[model samples]
Target: MAKKTTQATPKAAENEQQSATAQKPHILPDRVWLVLARRAYEEPLRQVGTVEADDIELARVYARSIYDEFAWVEMALVPRETLVTVIEA
Candidate 1:
């Protein structure tokens, strides 16, 4: 006696293919942003920290939320890729 094998129907195979396609990894829009802030007008902007966000507005909000403990007079966020490196250590 031979063992019986069950085969998937056409619809089931299509659904399986769709599910496999859907299960593929999706790339997120996040980018590394450098946060700059200054305590006072006299002080220069300093690289306080970094944040990951999809866009500049979100990065700004995230940076402020994370680093707002200080009484900073000015704050700015720029994508890390935009920074021109003069020297590397």
Candidate 2:
């Protein structure tokens, strides 16, 4: 006859999660960066996607890696905070 073993209970898992979170300090939320790119010289730059990053350099790296679907002629990153609201939506 084979021996039977018991699986971990939900309470035990919850305790482990609590301890893990307690050990680490709270972190600030990442800033949102708007990605804009233009495929051709004649075309206007359009918003392709967005990325969350700690700084501009990291944001640039993330934008390039995640939005590599196009061979854009020009690419730019604008911080979400800098944009002005011309029209309320």
Every model's TM-score:
0.65, 0.70
Give candidate 1's error at residue 51 in angstroms: 0.6
**TM match of model 1 to true structure:** 0.65
RMSD of each: 7.1, 7.4
- Residue 73, candidate 1: C-alpha displacement in angstroms: 0.4
Tens digit per residue, CA lDDT, model 1, 2-84: 99999999999999999998988476757999899999999999999999998778887899899988999998888889878
lDDT of each: 0.89, 0.94
| Residue 89 lDDT in candidate 2 | 93
Cand. 1 Cα-lDDT: 0.89
Score residue 68 of candidate 2 by CA lDDT.
97
Model 2 residue 89 CA deviation (Å) reads 0.6
For model 2, residues 2-24, the per-residue Cα lDDT tens digits are 98988889999999999999977
Give the CA lDDT, 0 to 100, for residue 57 in model 1. Answer: 84
